[model samples]
Target: MIVGTAGHIDHGKTALLEALTGQAGDQRREERERGMTIDLGYRYAALTPGAPLTGFIDVPGHERFIHNMLAGAQGIDLVLLVVAADDGVMPQTREHLAIVELLGIARALVVISKCDRVEPQRVQEVQTQVSVLLAAGPYAGAAPFMVSSVTGEGIEPLRRALLAAQSEVSQRSREGGFRLAIDRAFAVAGAGIVVTGTALDGRVQLGDTLLLGKAGKPVRVRGLHAQNQPATEAHAGQRVALNISAERLQLEQVHRGDWLLAEWLHAPTQRLDIELQLLASELRAFEHFSPVHVHLGTQDVTARVALLQGEQLLPGARMFAQLLTNAPLQAVHGDRLVLRDQRAQRTLGGGRVLDPFAPARQRRSEARLAQLQALASADSLEQALPALLACDDGGLDPQRLERQFNRLRSSWQLPANAQVIATRQGPLLFTREHWQALQNSVLEGLARFHTQEPDQLGPDRDRLRRFVALALERPAFISLVDELLAANRMSSSGPWLHLPEHRIRLSDADALLWSQLQPLLVDGAFDPPWVRDLAKALSVDEAEVRVLLRKLGRLGQVHQVVRDLFYPEATIRQMAAMLLQLASDDPVVQVAAFRDVLGIGRKRSVQILEYFDRIGLTRRVGDRRQIRADNALAQSPGQ
Candidate 1:
């Protein structure tokens, strides 16, 4: 379990954490001298025997470093909201509370620190004020404990409260795609590089290769630890320390905002759709397209906000908005964010991310805004999957879908009876309705091809690709084709593809043409006449001749030579026989001799010889032809 500290500046958040864990959270010399936290700090607490170890993230409480606080808060499983009994709720305290609420932190233990500094009556007064302030926050009804880190008063009660809160703490979603928001990066003498963060989703183990966001660099996990003890694997809600084998990276280079993730899981974007809520106590109103500082996970970015409902947003109003930023962010849907108005220099509101990687836009329609709102409210896979499919302008990539819906895929146990089409080009998600429609389209295409070219085996694969491309604009259409093949609804042979029942056949006219043309191929030197000439000879119309020729070509009963000339299978066989006979008598045969032996003119002779050369029957040597030594005919006797 991961616990995060939140409170106002100089409220002793780090001190309380140190007293609880016996570890100094503040490692910076300046922070120790100045007596204030300027950066994120870390400590660990050993739970009662038989309980899980707990890790704590001590965050800065100063308004200037609230961004750092947000970064630490991103991966915490539970929050420890600290309020000094003397000062009660301060500015940063409220801001931190707002951030925790937006981050969807539901389990918390409110701490009223510095109980020794105030009289009993004053402590009671401060507690009352703190209670009222938290009444509307995430910890509205949470149990508030009084503790003095200096004297360790009420320390055991605080521990008991935290342990009790653990029971109400909801288990992390175990199935989502893996995301690790890096908070601490350092170098180990012999271990190379190491990073530590709370594992947000999925599980990670030793030897797994993870991809760093944006950079796409592959890093191998050499070791893993949980709460200072070496472990083989770590799951969601656990604080994990990963030792990477790559070249050691600088602390600043890795930074707090970077993410270590499963390869190809998500793409970074500079825009997001968010459901925002302004605090009731905020003094100023937010105008449309106002500039603000946006903080999510561990990254701080300047964003221009586009209000969804109106021009001026009043305090405490829930609204949908788009955050457009110049810096790219590595985020996912359902992530939480904090926005601060640039002019007011005060934390304005908090929101949940709807589209983590959305395109930048100035003007959007009501329908689109409604779609974003729907996505924000989606809770289950059934609700979310369809919305994702609908939003995918082109077909989604199956590999991407598998990764994006990782949690859903495992828990939902998607039925195998449902057909999912995957093409080489894209993954097309199909509900039962979409799958049936695709089946109907494919059957119809095959039926049309059969009616138009009955003698042909089926449609050409290229033609089918073109047809599907025209019907489905997204890459997912290819996935549909794969589904058809897997279901045995379709079959492919060479460049041709068809429904299961498709076959090749020749028409009566084509049969007659084959019979008439077969005997003419005796000498292996005949150039069949053009379609018009064949029509005149056979006493048939030009269209009839063309139909017969096309059918013959499809059946492999004839070979087209140039535009109008053709040869039957028998012609090719006879040509091969004559060439074999000539090659048995001499190592080489001149083109003229071969042409004379075949009793053909120079044009037809050159064509036949070229065909032989193409098939490795003979090799061209300048103006002459030589029998290919590797040819099977060389082993046979014929002189």
Candidate 2:
């Protein structure tokens, strides 16, 4: 567990750490000369052998070093909020506590350091002041533990309390991918490049390759050390130091704010959708489009706030907003971060990343804002999804759904029976209610077709597709029909598709016409003539044969390629199969080749080739053609 020290400057933060750990924090020349922490200082304390191992991040208490403190606070499990007994609460003390709250550090042990310098009564007064300040925050009623690093007074009690606070911190899940924000990076004499940060999740093993950034080159881990020990692997919530080979990478290219993780999980983006929280004590409201410095993970970058629902956010107001960053951030969804003024001098507010890789234009829309709000407040992706899919009539885009999971770094398992409707525009999401509505639409359309066209077996698959607004793609429609058929909800015979519950029986006059028409169509075979020839062959009027053939076309028995030209689907399939076979053996089969195979005239073969090209069944190259696919029988758009 990682614990951080936060309070005013020179308030015995370093001294307390040294007393507990029995070593001065980061004994560097600059720190000894200046008598203050210039950058992050790290040291570890073993409270108990059986208890969890603990590490302390002693941050600079001075106001100017707040950014440095944030760098260390990113992965700490809890904070030890320090305040000097003699001085009580000072400017930096308040700022540091506010920062701790902004960073979403819920667990803390408030300590009155330097207790030896003040009287017992003074310590009581200071403790009261600290309690009153924390009254409205997450640590309300958390009693301050008085301690003096100068002597051993209250030292043992503080250690016990720190252990208890650390126990309360829930461990980060050790699943998914690993991400480490590089807080410290430099080159050692002969060990190559060393970078240190807390591993947020998963494990990073020695010799494993990790992507440097989004679309970044791969880097191999030459060696690794976790929790100050030479270890083979590291897991979540542990301080890790990685030794990377410096053959191709430059020192300047490795810096704070860059992230190391699996390539698929690296979604570096500039725009973010957030659920913002403004501090109630701020003097003014959070104005829209106001430039601010976003302290995310270990990196601080300039960004502007875009109020998603309104023009401004009043003090203490919680709302949905967008952060437009000047530089890319490696933050994921649900990562807590603070927002400061553009100059990096004041804390404006803080928020959680909702959509870290959000699109710019879509985020500004009102419809999207509602979805963002629902997702922001959800406890899990499963809880947020239904409302998210309900935002648009069209199903949710896969890319949009990924933002929620990627933002939270969640497991990507989808729920059962997750309804998805494929459309020409894209995949449209459907609720259970909507799926039911679709089933009704199909059954009702078929019933109406039966009522209107009594002589036909069912509606043409193409006609039913149009009647339903053509919302589903052809493939999706066919899949739905197949599913219905498997369930015995629908049935099909030859060219006809129909509900299993419905049937068509021919009338006396229609029966006589069908008997003659069926024979005429069968005798014509592969080279079936037009309606004119059918009427002459059957000794019927041309207009009457044309009307009867149209009825046959509705039954799915015949296919009409052009005006006055019709053939049974069986004949077309036979001709298509032969053409495909010829193209497979030959380089390219032209109309002449197909004419010879079908033993048909030039006009008929040319018409068939042109039809094949239009429907994506064949590709034309100069005077020759080739088969595009082998699915000529499944060419119904309505299917």
Candidate 3:
């Protein structure tokens, strides 16, 4: 268990830590000379013999160094809120208490220091003041311990209470990838570089490779110490110092607020959707787009709050908002954050991160708001997923879903109503209702199109996508189409997509004209005649021949290689087979070779190859084309 000290400056916080640990707390030269802690100080000791070590973080109580105090406050199990009996409930004391409350640190032990210097009545007065302060916060029932650091009065009892509280400190869940917020970094003799911080989640073993900072520079852990004791590995909720090394890493490149993370947990973002509360202490309302200092983990960055609910947030009220930071911040769901004024002078309030990957636009939409509300009310992804999927129509990316929740795929408690559809991008998660609705929408859409235009077969994939009138990603929609085709619920011919039951046939007059046209197209199968030439040979109007051929093209009876040019569907299939044979020798099918195989002119070969490219049969790269393995034509001519 880690305990942090919080109080006004010169309240003997560091001195109290020294008394408890039997070790000097103010080890810095400046701190010893000034008789105050200028920065965060640390001490570790087993309060009772054979008991687990209890780490102590003695934070500077000066208002100017509140940022330093906040750095040490994160990941602590309990807080020792020290109040000097001689100066009861000072300004920094109140601010520190408010910070602890905002940080959601529920366990606190109030300590009234310098009791020997004050009379019993004065000590009682300080306790009453502390009680009133705790009454409105999470530490309401915490009893105060009176002690004089100089005399060691009541010291033994305070140590006993700390041991008792340590038993009640629940262990942090070790379900996420390892992450440590770096607060101090330096070089040690014979060691390349070392970084110390509280391990926020997961575990790290000796020789484990971890990514460092937002740049994700890879580093190997050479050694580690957990809770100030050398160990082979360290897990969450322990103060740890890692001896890390990389080829390019230097002490200058690392600083406070940088993170040591597992490879899968290295995503850093500039925007965070959060549930914020305005402190009742604020005299004025917090306006939209208000600039403030955002403190999460051990990092402090300047950010502007974009209010999601209203133009202004009243003091003492809670609201959801998005924070747009000037620099990237590494955060995950449920991570606590504090907001100070833009000047970084005073604590305004704090909040919990709801979504680290916040959308830049439409964040105020009803659907988005509902999703945020769901995320706010739930503690885990499993609890919030039902409402989230209900509001999100596009379905969730399984990769992002797992990453957002900081859990591995094996640990996810996926809902039974959820469906996973495989796409080239990754697996997409959709509620069964939403998935069925998408499939039905496609079928119903094709049926409606057939009814409206009985002469036309159906729209192509791109046109069908637009016709559906729903916002689905292209990859996911392609996956949906493939699934339907595999299930025999929908079918595609050439470039057109339609329901299996929908079909278009040539009218009798057009059919008769098509019969006369088929002979001309098949006679020179490799180099079909243009519509104007066919019409001239048949002694018919060029416009009529063009209309008849276009109708045939729609019914998959003919291929329109180019404007006014048509080929018999069988001839096109034969040409595709020839190209595939050429591609077998070398995947790159050049135009010269294709033209030679078809015994056609250069222009005719280029046109036919371009048509093949258009239908996803082949992809053209420069002057050569590569056959697409997934193309049905490549698999077999009958397809």
Candidate 4:
């Protein structure tokens, strides 16, 4: 369990910590000279034998160092809100209490420090004032504990209360990828670089490689100390110091706001959609697009708030808003953030992040707002999945979804009967109802296409994708088309896709022309003739010959490799088989290997390979091509 001290400057926050742990606070020369805490101080104690250690973070109480104080507030399980008995409730004391309350720190032990200096009546009066302060907000029932660091009075009782609260500290699950917001980084003599911060999620072991910061530089964990003791591994909910090693990595590259994270969790974004609340103590309303200093984790960046619902947010009111930052920051859903005025002088309010990767357009659309509302209400990824799928019309990106929840893919609790469509990019998740709607749209679209153009076989895959008029990704749309084809609910005639019942045949005149063209194409088999050559051989007009061949191309009798060049349907199938056989041995089929396989010249092979790419028979990768098994032409003729 971690406890943080919060109160006014010179209010005995550091002195109380010193007395509790028997460790001196205000260690810095500047702090000692001034008799004040200028930065955060750390100490630990084992309240119970054979139990985990209790860590203490004594934060600076001066308003100028509030940002420093905030850096230590993260991962705290309980707050020690201190108020000097002589001073009663001071300005900084109220501000510190408000900041903790806005941060959603519910467990607190309000302490009236320096009780020895004041009379008994004065101590009681301060206690009564602190009780009233706690009576409001989330800490309504919290009681005060009076203690004096100098006299050792009420100190034992406070220690006993903290020991009892240990059992109540809920352990954070170490289920996701490792993440630690670095608050301090420096170099040691022989240990190389060392970084200390709170482990936010997952676990890390000695020798494990973690991506450092937004650059995703890989670094090995040489050793670590968890909860102030040397350990081989460290998990979430503990204060940790890691000795890391990497090639060419310097102390300058690692900053206080940087993060040590699992490789896949290194994404940083400039925009965040959050559920914000303006502090009731604010003198003015929070105007939309107002400049503010956003503090999340240990990083502070400038940003402008974009209200999702209204032009301004009144004090004490909660609303969904988007924060646009000037610099990128690492964030995840449910992470808390604090906002200060543009000048970075005072606290305005804070909120919990709802989405770290917010879209740039249509962010305030009705559907998007509904999705944000659902996200705000959900307590976990499991509860949000269904609601998100229902409200998100553009479908869910599986990678983004996993990152939003800070959950590993293996640990995701997917909704029952959830449909995951395999795409080239990755898998796309959809609910059954949405999946059905997409399928219905495709079938209905084909039906309308048949009605509009009875002469044509149907639209090709690319055309059909556009005709559907939906916001489906190309890979996802292709997967849906393949699913429909495999189920016999749809059919593909070479490059064209249509309803299984819809078929096209050549007219009588075109059939006669095809008869003359068919033999010529079959005879030329491997090296087909151009439209002009075929027209010259048949003693027919070039335009007439081209028109007839196009008709046959739609009927799946011949393949138009190019605008003029054509191949018999049988020849194209033979070429597809040869490419597939080459892919069977090695998925990447080079132009040279394919030319040898076809026993054709390099030019002809290149032409055919380019044509295969156009018809989706293969995907080109630099000088090679990968045969696509999902393509209709790649299948055997019997199928």
Runs in model 4 deviating more than 4 A are 48-51, 119-125, 522-533, 559-639
> Considering lDDT, which of the candidate structures 3 and 4 is the better prediction for this target?
3
TM-score of each: 0.68, 0.71, 0.91, 0.89
* Residue lDDT tens for model 4, 93-178: 88888888777776888788999898999988888888787776777767777788998998999988888887788888898889
Q: Which stretches of candidate 3 lie over 4 Å from their true place?
A: 519-528, 558-562, 566-638
Best by TM-score: 3
RMSD of 2: 6.7
Output the worst ten-in-a-row residue range by lDDT, candidate 2: 630-639
Q: Which candidate would rank higher by TM-score, 3 or 4?
A: 3
The sequence of per-residue lDDT tens digits that candidate 1 reaches over residues 1-639 is 789999999887888988888887647999878888988888877756677778889999998887788889987878888999888889888888888887888778889999999999988887888889888765777667889999999888888777776766777887766788888788888776788888888888899888875676678899999776799988888888898765544445576677888775756777777888887888778789989988877778898998877888888988888888878787666777888878536788888877665545433665467567667768654566665555433433445445434443445533333445654454355556556776668667777877887767665443565654434643344455556667898875422457778777666756676676555443234655776777676677878766666666565556555555667655655666777777668767777877888776898888777866754567899977887543323323131
The order of the candidates by lDDT, greatest first, is 3, 4, 2, 1
Q: lDDT value for candidate 1?
A: 0.73
The C-alpha lDDT values of all candidates are 0.73, 0.78, 0.90, 0.87
- lDDT score, candidate 3, position 256: 96
- Tens-digit lDDT track of model 3 for 153-183: 9899999999999999999988889989998
Model 4 clashing residue pairs (backbone): none
Pairs with backbone N, CA or C atoms under 3 Å apart (clashes), candidate 2: 333-407, 395-428, 395-429, 461-638, 462-638
Model 1 alpha-carbon miss at residue 461, Å: 13
